[model samples]
Target: MSQTINYQAQSPTHEIESKPFDEKNQVEHVNDVSAAKELSNFKMDAMEAEKAEHNMTVLEAVKAYPWACFWAFVMSFTIIMESYDVFLIGNFLALDEFKRQFGILDHNTGKLVIAAKWQSALQMAGQLGALIGVFLAGPLTSKIGYRWATIVALIAMNATIFVMYFADSLPIFFVAQLLEGLPWGIFIANAPAYCSEIVPIKLRAPATQVLQMFWAIGSIIVGAVTYHYNPMSGKKAYRIPIALQWMFPTPLLVLMFLAPESPWWLVRKGRLEEAAKSVNRLGRKSRLNANEIVAMMRRVVENEKEGSISYLELFKMPDLRRTLIVSGVYAAQNLTGNLIANQAVYFFQQAGMSDQTAFALGLITSALQMIFVMLSWILTSYYGRRPIYIWGTAFNTVMLFALGIAASVGKSNAASQAQASFGLIVSVMFTFAAAPVGYAIIGETGSIRLRPLTTGFGRAVYYIVEIPCIFLASYMLNPTGANLGGKCGYVWGGTATVCLILAYFFLPEMKGRSYRELDILFHRRVPARQFSKTVIGPEEDE
Candidate 1:
């Protein structure tokens, strides 16, 4: 990527203009060494740099850009706390002290518990807040840049933690969660895009997948922490875990200040000098040619410079398809039944397991999810996203169906065990394929011009989908409600089946392709299945 060359296609007389040039000539010189005279006389210096980066082996790219990889991982740490907070509230409902503080007496179950309506309300409160946060993240990060935007969010998240820690009632806790969602939204939506930008093309998927790993890691910690505190009888039980959440942002905050800024974001703003410096910091070891790489980024920025920069643009032409694809990718995870698996502690408790077993199973399930997410790094590399995502959805369909069958076998211990086992299996399949892949795709799918904003719109779709699912789960799991237990599997199973069909028709393979290649393919409106075989350039390099 460091090498520079002269473009014989002499267009020195052509005035500099910011418009989407002919896509046909975009890659003409990139991989061609023949006498195919380049088009328009415009030098392919930028395309050449990008081609070099794209042609790199995974190992070559990693060794060359170690600091970029390091910062990507570090920036993703914010997700750990975000995940922790998400699970903490659901599990807390099962704690003795939490029940006393927030639960209403349930005559049917003859026990104290948070009402189903309240449970769904609490979950939605956070989702509503996150939706608002996602809306802000795109513009906020765009204007201020990732580093400062993150600093602002971390500080805001810490401030919200105080409210969660001191809350003595359900209403107060609800407000706290709702408020906390603002920053959590910022972190979740922006983290993947930031990570995607810092790493080289070969490492992009793996880097974005790290966000899911951190999410599983966060869930595991919350499970262990919540399980250990399950024996407590007072407010300390819940407060201690909430207090630990405050610690996540501090270390992440420090790392944010210390990490290199995203070179892509810098280039988008026409700040080449800053972008070059950022690139040098990220890949100094490999001797990255900042001038060439910056030009490469500039071309990408130039091509996407069409349309006024606004959310409305996201719904227009090429970007609309990009928007729908990303939105579908995000929504697919929820359809696969993450809401239940994510809160296995609460899901298990309602399914007839004792509190201790419920917590233990939740921990084990979370640990398994983490392990599978680790496995995803390998699967994604070999199988690419299209197959893994489709296969995972198919597997989800079967496992959720089996879970429903087990639940319908009646309330026997064996039936309960069968339901629990299937839930774990479903979670395993999800993390290995559906769950992790969504994070990666969100990073890769959108146009660079409006990535964060598009991601926000996509996440908004997720919360919109989840809102109905939350209400459904509340009705199904609530003792005062249907108390369907594992029978709820039928609902998610149906959703997974729908998602599978949709993915088959819509999802495309983007395994080793660069953004420029992808841009050409999408512009031509190629078939989704033809993505891998339909070559863009005449002699596109491997």
Candidate 2:
């Protein structure tokens, strides 16, 4: 059985005059104290109401929000398109046919080899365009809404894929890669923000985790396709994978028209009625009170207006701390040696493995990553965010350092090969748990009005870090360059250790908080450790 209490009617702001504890009134006084305590508990319940129904379990929340889950799953395909190209380009770099078309002859080894500069350029071009797109996401999403922004991005992305498919020279390929990155940046910036806005607090982590899971799924598809097409010569082998990019965005574009606009975005734009309707659509069968949810959203929007929505505000007082934490978390993701996983096919090939063996290992890594991402969704829901993040960071640091040492010992040695392979697999598995959670955290940390801008800014910082990291990774791994191979892990490992310490001290637990409650907590300057236990009442001053 369930009961509903009207805590809103018993406003905590009402005052009770202090009276002397008299023997005649002692029983009444005791009753008064008990009632006050119960009221306090009720106030806490009201604050958490936005997070979930008064007493609903996570399973119940899922059963209630099937449409929300479906929407999240559909939006996640954008990540698949992004992930496909990430693995596709790396695998192509190691392909015999791709090498024959693009590589210069290395007389010493009597084999065609792509130069380190070209390889680095290929990866960095996308990052450069992604940086630009991230900066543009704020205005794009703000103007047209996430749905239309994504649709426009998809249209542009498909156009670029055609260019990439027909590209013959390195310069043309670079241009195509840069062009492809524009939409990817927009999708990455907006998709998780959309997921955060539409789903219940309990489901946010899982929904965003699904976004990352698709990334691994894309990698798996590319790995398998590239391996199967290994025997083909010239453009045919690489063209097939390049053409596959068209599959994701075309259907996603049409689906966006059917999707509802983000309720938060509507509220920010002063479309209150539309926002309420969006909320009802998203929370159709849920226990959530749509009117109450809209009211909460309105309160946050009104509060946000007190502080203007400017980029400079992101660095001002209360928002500054959040901006730093979110940006740093995104940067920390890159420092986990994920680039090595991104370039796994090439890394294995450079270490003297056959093309088939290298692609097979890449496929295995992606499969393991997909499995771990699903596991992370469950773990994130049960264990909360900070502990899992800390644990994953610690594990990544140790594995990277170990792999670096193994690579430094001797690349061709059987012992080194086994150690490096083991290190790559284990490090990636650990990384899946923490790395993707950063997106959910970034989405949750911002004020409702600034959500898109905050995520876009965070992603811009992400690409700023990624651009140099990708270039450095290509330099160290490309056979024509420094060829550090597994030793590159040592670089990222040292940085991951620093990120681990920062996360422990700064990343607040935001597992079950609504966007409105998060604004209050951040405004109040609550300590990270106390976020989960601290009870906030409506009348409490910010």
lDDT top scorer? 1
Q: Ten-residue segment with the worst summed lDDT in candidate 2?
A: 12-21
> Could you give candidate 1's per-residue lDDT for residues 1-542 as a string of tens digits?
22322332334424233223544355555546343433212236666677778778888888888899899998888888778988888788788778887789998778999888888888778888888999999889889888998899999998999998998888898899899999988988898899988888888888999998898899899989988988987889889999998778888889899887898898888888999899888886455777778777776777664776678989887888889999998888788978777768887887778999999998998888888888888888667989988987898899999989999987788988898888878877788888888888889888887888988889888888887788887788888889888888898999899999999998989888777677777777888999999877723322
Q: List where candidate 2 sits over 4 angstroms from the true fold.
A: 1-54, 411-413, 538-541
Task: Kindly state the number of residue pairs that clash in model 1.
Answer: 1
For candidate 1, the TM-score is: 0.91
Q: Which ten residues in a row have the lowest lDDT in candidate 1?
A: 1-10
- What TM-score, computed on C-alpha atoms, does each candidate reach? 0.91, 0.89
Task: Kindly list the per-residue Cα lDDT of model 2 for residues 228-252, writing each as its tens digit.
Answer: 8888976889998898888888898
lDDT of 2: 0.80
Write down the lDDT that model 1 would get. Answer: 0.83
* Cα error, candidate 1, residue 522 (Å): 1.2
